[model samples]
Target: MAKNHLLLSFSFFSVLIIAQISHIFAKNTSKSPIVIQPYIIDYRNGTVTKYYNGPASFVPPPIDSQVQSKDIVIPSPSYHNLRARVFLPARPDPSRKIPVLLYFHGGAFCIGSAFGWGDSHYVAKVAAEARVIAIAVDYRLYPDFTVPAPLEDAWAALEWVAAHASRAGPGHDPWVAQYGHLGRIFAGGDSSGATIAHNLAVRVGMGHGPHLSGLFLAMPYFLGSKRVPLEPKWFPFSPNYKVWPYVCNHCKGGVNNKFINPFGRGAPSIAHLGCKKLLVYTAEVDELRGRAIWYYKRVRTSRWPGQARWIEAKGQSHIFHISKPDDPATTKLIRDLSAFVNSN
Candidate 1:
């Protein structure tokens, strides 16, 4: 009887241990970390990659008199259509064609839309104040669309805008009809959107010559590699952070070849960019600061007769200059960006 009782006690303890182990494993498996920092990849190989968290729908703020926002649709490659928000100045002089600023939102290629507060809201304000036509593009995101899908969408939108600009206005110069000068096309964005901006500029430059007059990137993540090459103060390892190959695989449900990875694809050649100017904004405390800085340096050192202006907030971090209007950094960013647009 004593032996049996001892055996029973041992068996109970063993079962408890097994149960605990199983529970732990189940918990981890269910909530696995999505953004794992790569261990071996050297981020210096010109890879600019990052990830974004899934987004929930957000209600926009109250509309004001400064800008008029309208939705427009464009055709997509997959027998579908994409949407965009056109922000036009309230008091427009029909006689003069305005320059179009093609803007993309930054949500790490996941949770952003063309009409988001960061991109659309700010661009509208800038357009109205600076008198530029702002077209905030809403490109398709990942998991539903794969790598280059977003890029393709961006290119298509550009072409669509260029093609339709003439018809968008009456008596307006066909080339400058919709948004002023076709040669004055300015592409810009923040975060992942910035990546797209740089990619589009590079591709256009590499091809027949860029239709873009300038490229503006704010805290741009132009790499597809894993590690961010910096010890960031924020949620660097959060599930929202991701790299290429891994992100592309996860996004498309399969691994894609490395040649198409923009950042890892190597530094873009400046000769193809022609004479377009570049405006790169960097946050002092952003995780991708190193990459942005690196890009700025490369562009500044390039052979192109373009200008590279770097605006680093003294005490601002990633997205810090975007949110909360009361913040001084945000105010500074607005001023700087507006000035850049006006000068360009």
Candidate 2:
């Protein structure tokens, strides 16, 4: 009967619609070209929980019980009591001032924290094992506050570290004659953190910030786009880095300009303004390779170059070195960074 046919057609269409909806959800959930395991959920309530997708897990190495950890406040307009972590070297000699390294973390300025630095242990180990003091900053995130907020926090932290070095620890002051004058006060970070570090170097070298001794940029993302950052669905290769499901949330309903990205768009060039030594590292396979290379070239052509070095890692991706400890590439990076800090 015609009635029976109509009912059957409706049922078929309903099934089709359900299937399509399910498929779309699945695609969106795993749309990234490169899949990053060990997922995390950041809730509106300020709760952070990690979700592991693979058998591999985060097994932190043993810590030195003698090492001390403390928090120092950095001034920020966007947030009250902006803070940074100070990793004191074990067995500090009060008469000796240790070198300071201001480390910024990478999460595209949207997802990282000073406390959640997965590689904090590595740096702390270096600080303890290498006799250096590392200050890890928790800069502002996007949507809530953009561009200058992050940069401002970075500069403020550097200034605070320089001015309050003595307060953080006995003989921690970089300017004091005790610790060889804090040998080298360097700024460094991975990914977006690297981008900020590079920008700070340029700013400081140009007399915009307190004097800095060196710069270390790892896999920086220095570009901004009006269009959503996610690649076209037709692209074949997956970049291991996540594209942030809510990439547009921050840029939405706002005028696209340098305010959103000071390093992106048309910003003043700092290449010629750096006074201290600079080292830039990039992975060949990283999607951000082009931008990293561009920044490196800018450093060379800039007018205020003091000393610059660029190294391209073989068979590595963005943040890949830090994510995998057993990887030979990661080991080399740590050694090179330690050497740079020591020699510079």
Candidate 3:
């Protein structure tokens, strides 16, 4: 009877161990999946495929048929696939140098592409309407890469443009060589791209310069660990709550680092902003409007040696201009952007 009891006890313990192992496996598999694949991949054989499993769903055509556009792959030491899409005005005058705009696309630092349909269309329109040489940078995204990676790519693209504009030697982009005016350069973007633009401007302000004339921020994305008035109460606990830390893990101060939240407490003051002029466009209904407005107020009141202006599109939502470029409000915003870029 004692022998029988020992066998039964061993069997019970074995069953318990198996159940525990199964539970652990289920717990792990139940958690949300993290995506690590590239959103869009070019096979170097005239084929590009976009992975739809993640947020990056739109696959831009290889070429923008509406405007004179070309994709140039930037050689990078760290990242092998950095690229930029260059858009030229319909009537680019080789004799007259026009302003240049280095644009970044919005996708929460994770999803969008320079060659995405919306970005391509928007840059093409801006190039045609604003009569400026536009280059949309395709920076590395998150989960696979991280924050400073994108910033580094942006800086690299800017440098490349400056180099091409300064000297149109062999192997230079003809559009940039023919029309790009180095002195009147502008950096602009929407959403997270706007955030990158802001950070880039700040970096430039700290002694580096190709001399930015202006900055165009459309529905700029700025946030902190704490929630502010008019923002959702649960904002602090959202999925993106961890975004700053995840992307900026290398930052010394974590989420509160100057690069993550430039306007937050302890962050470098807006007085360090490099551009001579700042134009901020916000949609009234956008959840991020309040933050942009706050930034405008702070910059305007700060000792920054520049003019800061804000334009609110009533009843509009986040990134409305990019999604609805033909809308009257978007057209107005574009007109304002054109004027801002052309302004002295």
Question: Can you give the TM-score per candidate against the true fold?
Answer: 0.75, 0.68, 0.81
- lDDT for residue 87 in candidate 2, whole number 0-100: 74
On a 0 to 1 TM-score scale, where does candidate 1 land against the true structure? 0.75
lDDT of each candidate versus the true structure: 0.65, 0.63, 0.78
TM-score of 2: 0.68
Give the clashing residue pairs of candidate 2, or none: 33-238, 97-179, 272-302, 272-303, 272-304
lDDT of 2 by residue, 24-130 (tens): 99977665333233334444344433333233223333366755566666665555677677677666798866678888888765666666536665556556655
lDDT per residue as tens, model 3, 122-241: 778888788888888889876477788888887877677777755655347877777788888899999889988998898888878456889999998788666666666766654444
lDDT of 1 by residue, 1-344 (tens): 99999999999999999999999999877665443432112233343233433354443632759877777677665666777777777767777777778888776565567656655557767676667777777887754665577777788777766665445532222323644656677888888788788778877877643378778888886543444455354534443344444335544322122222333434456555533688888888777777677767766776777787898877787766446544777667767776776684
**Model 2 misplacement above 4 A:** 1-62, 65-67, 75-79, 165-183, 224-265
Q: Candidate 3: TM-score?
A: 0.81
lDDT of 2: 0.63
* TM-score-best of 2 and 3: 3
lDDT of 3: 0.78
The candidate maximizing TM-score is 3
- lDDT, residue 32, candidate 1: 52
Residue 158 accuracy (lDDT) in model 2 = 71
